[model samples]
Target: VRATQNAKSKMAEVMPDVPKKLDDWKAAADTLDQGGQIVSLYHQLAIFTRPSEATTAEENAKVIWRGRGFELNNDTYMHRQALMACLPMTLSEKLHNDMRRMRRVSRKTVANAIHLAPVIGEWRGTATPTLILAGRRGQLMTLDLYDNDQGNFNGAIIGTPGSGKSVWMNEIAWSYRATNAQVRLLDLGRSFEKLCSKANGQFIEFGPHSPINVNPFTVVDDIDRDMAMLTPVIAKMASLSAPLEEVQYKAINAGILRVWRAHGKDMTITALRDLFKTGTLEDLEIHNDVRIKDLAIMLEPYTRNGQYARFFDGRANIDFSNDFMVIENEELKRAPDLHAVVNMILLYQITQDMYLSRERGDHRKKLLMIDELMQQLGEIGADDPVKARVVEEAARRARKYGGSLITATQAADDYYSSKQMETAFQFADWVFLLRQKKESLELLDRSGRIVMDDAKKRLLTSLRTEPGVYSEIYIYSPMGEGIARLILDPHTLLLFSNRHEDNQAIDQRRARGLSIDQAIDEVLRERSGKPS
Candidate 1:
């Protein structure tokens, strides 16, 4: 009130205008008179630059400030004062006196002053950050996918095709490997092949004419546990238009037990199907009914002499010996009917391996990354309740056994498409949302999940991706939601590149007796025509 009475100036002085400053002061004085709190605000910035690039740095600063409708002062004389003000716990008497005399300040009521400082928008991730990223304003924001008090590292990555989600998530899975975490990828389109190779990981491609195959019938534990685990995969194979009936499930269960009794630890779906063909469940009082015979025809495609036999019925050939394994099913993904059932089988088989790994060694942290997850989740869940439970349990059991379940989808609704899918999504404490079409955004709005508000929804629609540069994404977790840019360096880009030409280049160099790193470097050098 005293400053407002005596220090009223008529001219528009310095930076923030004089008459407007007095108006602000009058408001503060009124608040003071009414016994409300009045507060003062001050700000300082110190930009460090090379002597050669000082002018360029100053212009960049002007561009940033001008975007916010503020003019830059370029006060060369106050450099020392600026440095002094910015250094924490180093207040100088001379700088304080100079600030008092200069009137380079703003005063407002407490409510207004609170917004001026002490409220940094950036989220500082956990102490040991798994992924480092940059906020929109170039502030440093990071992600602590593991080693945080949040209790679970499960998360999702959602974006439209060509939105750079593959590269972004490949980088994340790569980063987790740095922490010695075991990583496995269930992928479509072979998005993880390059990185898997780079990490000396197992890359098993499931398709016709492929050397690898997935057999879910192997006995990992007791017969009952293996039976319970195979229940979902078997249900997915037999049921086409509807969920399996109780009688069919019991018949399938009886057939599986007989196969185990016959083959012991070495069993396959072909063996189970053969057992079902014969009327031989007399011991358990579970006779082969007509429904069981109908199931045999449905299960024929997965049998030895059936069409989809090679891909579905064999002993598992891959190993968890390495910390990383990418099980890519591009061919199966193309076959919509087969993709849903195989996905459920793979999810359980991987977790069973996880259980075996726990028994063999220390319970080190592991990561299960499922790419192209949107379509299969809801369809499989609604079609087969048993498979849906297994799918959701894969994510839930990940946290229980010191691991994380990370999935990527095309949109938000796909994550919440079914009750089981929503349950799986609820386990995701961290999520990445990239660019979306306007129509996709509208669907997300109507999906009835309170994911983002109007402003954030607008932000999501405006996200962008550059082919060789950075891609912008909205990162969400229990901590907070903020935008981040995933900018990969040239080498890392080559490691994550799935483009056929780039991959062919890498493969050509590798065929010439080059290591993964050496081949990638050769590719980078060839692209740039400069040795790097």
Candidate 2:
């Protein structure tokens, strides 16, 4: 209190004629508050004083504060508040400017941060992951997005025949070249050449004349892993055809197991065949004659020349000379058994290999992209035991082994009828629905309980304006992220910025090495009705 009184006494001595009017003192105080510091406060007060009234009094007051060594600490809230109170209008302007500047800086910082962050990983632990292409407009597009690493993915891409399905697949294939992912394409239509070229990956064609034609009777070692899948089914079928006696059925099953075990620990058809050719019924411990007969018949197509003879013979005669060979022979035409056997075997082998790869801690992700998957489903009727087992096993192992099986078709209903398809769908952690036909969409929507009405309405509205380019994509991932919708635009085919740049580079290369000027001239000339 003594210091405060002394300070006030000195201030009064320096400003003997200081403003006594309340209004003048309030105005000066307002200016001092905004200025913040004692020096700035005194300067602002002087500026507020009228020129006609710029007497020694105001000058003396400023000198007094300066000489007294008065200071305002900006860091203190109370001091700042006092400063602001002294300069209300100036404080308001300064606060407004400061907020605007801060907002601008924040926006720029956020944009830079997003740009620096790499895209999210789509397939967990996979360096080379299978990319999901969403149909945007008329082109197949992919977003620079990834689902959480929960061992599942959902993707939907829709387009007509020429709408770039193959192109999109090619792009995805190429994207994984640098990673440890392997792609096994079951392309009925050989459209992955460009993808193969860009990724520098090998393409094995599995059409007719391929040495890997399906055969259940052929020795497993020489057999295409795909064709070997039918052995168990054939054994089962043979048992079903026998008498209804339980003893006979059990015996048949035992004989089949003997054959399976005879293949040794590896469990292949070749071992089974060797066992039948060398081992006696006593060796197999088969007490029932009916079981032996059934087993012999089951082996006949593979070992003897009969109705199913060609199926086994074609596979046996295939030149094991090449690691990969095409089996294009008339025998394949008459041998439906061979076709079924081969496809099943291939599916089995691929799945097993994938599982083994996982066991070894190999980080290479595998993708089985099946176009016209419905056709394969159709071949294996719902009642077919072999189809059911293979599909179930494949679906189950696919997730466990860090592999994915993508099935694409024109309509979901055609494929959804099979119990196997349903099982596979349930196991599939992700589902993608592209621009489907109205009926097809309704069927899927109803089955999945998606809001079909709103989707249909929006789709119709978009289509009327954009024609074939407009479509919708719905994705569901296993991590409970649930469904997400996106509109497809043909203009942006590839979603990632890097992928887009790569496509642009490819386009430029395909332009026949024309200079920019020449290309522009060609376009202009073409538009002007001139021949280039």
Candidate 3:
């Protein structure tokens, strides 16, 4: 009984101060209600629970009851009865503490789920709905679709062959198709067959037999920056062997400019080659000299005379009148004109289209994915006039005209010599790095101006693994904010997000050219190993 009395004495001391605090709160609440300020009371209540002085039971009861009434009150009545009712002070205190605890628990649960799960689902508008997958060597792979805002996306997959790169690429393609995006793939490795099958008749295969009839030179939507850099080199080569007494190099440039102005709208490698085959020295009013021979040699690399023709001859059955061109050849030739002219034709076409689209106020987004861009650029030195101009335009103005260029290569060192590549790297909104060779990583680090702390270095180092399982992604935004991190597991399969059984059935049906119902039956029959 004596111990209980002492505890009661302590409560009395604490309880008196509570009422005083409540008195002040009551006055404040009353003023807020009369002045039409009660709408903000809930926010104040949330703030008040944090280490403030206690209030009287009567005063506290008013605040608590009013808070409760505020919640239950309809939109119509909430303004009128903002401070009339009183609540039990003890109950209100208990409720607030419980809510705080619940919120903390909920946050922790979501964090854990995100850490363990894969990003799945198609992007709606500009949002990237991704699934993070665990990759080898403590890396995380993420499949993201960045809407270029034209009509297409800048799509990429980072993983080694067995690490699920192919699976992820196919899944992304499938998701894009679901949104009604037309995908034109130049799959040199033939890794997209399963994905192509899923597109039904939309899928077109381009091999040696059913080739694309369009010339790479003619379909200029956007000039590749790398190609632009090669132009001056071609010009220089054209000047090298010209006899001193022949038509000046400036005249040749002027004539070439005239050709571009007159025929640039319909210019293509096929067209240019035709021009060279049928056009004579009289067309440019120049003498036939060793300089002409040099010009021919410089343009030899880009001409259709060699193994390069196989690329033009191997396109699928799709119409290239409006679509982007895809060349499958990887060989590097010595002729500067061949390289320069091919690139020029493409660049001119792209820029011309962009100009027309801009004039018409067309906002359709487009994407140009150039694989092994460095290989093409390396053939043209910095001195090439036409190549230089092409690269400059691609890096600078393509984005304004609703086009985005995505270039991928194995190493950053390959682009070191070309100013065009350097320019693209500087302006590229995003830079993605997968498991890179040490030399390649160093080059990228230096070129991108990346500064790493101990934690970041650790992350980058961890990304380098055997058979290259880990990928270090460096995302640079034109908005000025950048993110660099190590994904512990790379989500390589976008297909895992789909209903796997449904997708498999669709694939089987597509291969057999069956209707949806028939496809379902065929898949079941195949699974059961029975004839349908």
Candidate 4:
């Protein structure tokens, strides 16, 4: 305080403008209260002066110090008779003091300190072509797929049940649909019906008796690559508990090659099965131990006279031309025995389409959202090479093509428990961690997907489990990793709503022959009329 007063006095003597600056500060202090006096503080100095013929800058500084009644010592203490500077400890002090370090501040202050703009991770200045509104901070956040030049835009949405994982994904699909991006959902829970209907997308439902043609043998152009892609899928479909023997793999390969050669555009799973059933196994050069008969017997159910033969006997019923498409497996959800095979086939088909779209130079951005991925992952072994290859291939295609994948499940441990699932997680550039179980939280804390400090981990661990519009999440991406609260727009919220009353109202309005927009308006009106 005394040093500051001395400096102010010295400034008053040397400069005429010092008095007016002091007066302005005094006026500001007076406006606050009677006890509010501005105390100017100074420390750490390097003296500089305009050159004068009368004295050097060093001598002038010494004169100013002496005039302020500061004492100068002898040569023993004062190394020079020139200007001296002091780097006071206070001037270099850090803001994180013991008393305030542990306290919490307002979100605004935290946002400012971290430069957390009220925008998405990819928002620089101009709007991005493929990003969608993820959630809100101070404003809406747009999630960019092609970020960091990685050319891969894979993501994972992990949380416990009722944590709004499905809702967030629905919002993403809606946003992309708004921008004319090709959006597809490999939906397990049948949660995308309303959203698909709203978007006028192809809603292809598959069931035990539903005659939906999904021919896996339709992949024929690049036989080797297509055969390689279907290997895991066929293994999964056959409910192969263990990895296929080398000869068994080769047998399946030979059968597929023959089927493609014979059928060409008329390729079907029935024909593929017929090729194996010709009883010409030894002629195909397969090893004695690897029975083509065994594979053909397992695949008999998907043949012409079998239970699922109706679905694979004809050409593919669903096309990928729609902007939004949902391939829902409602029956398989109840039949856990079929999820592995069915999902594998479905995903492999999508993979083929992704490659085809890129090959044909389709510039439209694509998204493949797989909901309840854990169900499918649960059926496959942890270290299954076939599943691993499928995952690796998906990640690779995401890079080659401009498509992004968003896979959601109940827990992070579900992915971590399996090598195939974990590979997919590692390949994902963006990770959205919603309200998680304590066990999943521990796994994620130790995982490489997101590096969180103690404070961040604590915040994530203590997140409220209640689900709503503001579905709290901590997103880890290339731009930065931090907590975000996502709130959907009213129309999107209505289109993909999981609320019981909202669904009832929508159904009622639709039964009255109202259009989707009119149904949404009616629902919104009814909701607004209700008391808060």
Pitting candidate 1 against candidate 4, the one with the higher lDDT is 1
Q: lDDT for model 1, on a 0 to 1 scale?
A: 0.75
- State the lDDT of candidate 1 residue by residue for 71-181, as single tens digits: 778666777767777788766666666776788665567877776564576655556677888877778766767754655778888888788888888988899898788
In order of lDDT, best first, we have: 1, 4, 2, 3
Can you write out model 3's per-residue Cα lDDT over 302-403, one digit (the tens) per residue? Answer: 346644454343221334333333443322235443444444444444545555666676555444545445544545455443454566576455665655
lDDT of 2 by residue, 51-95 (tens): 787566666666766675743222233344435534645545565
Query: What lDDT does each candidate get?
Result: 0.75, 0.46, 0.44, 0.68
Worst 10 residues of 3 by lDDT: 38-47
Position 230, candidate 3: lDDT: 28
Q: What does each candidate score in C-alpha RMSD?
A: 6.2, 18.4, 14.8, 15.9
Q: Which candidate achieves the best TM-score against the true structure?
A: 1
Task: Show the colliding residue pairs in model 1.
Answer: none
Give candidate 1's error at residue 160 in angstroms.
2.1
- What C-alpha lDDT, on a 0 to 100 scale, does residue 133 get in candidate 2? 42
lDDT of 3: 0.44
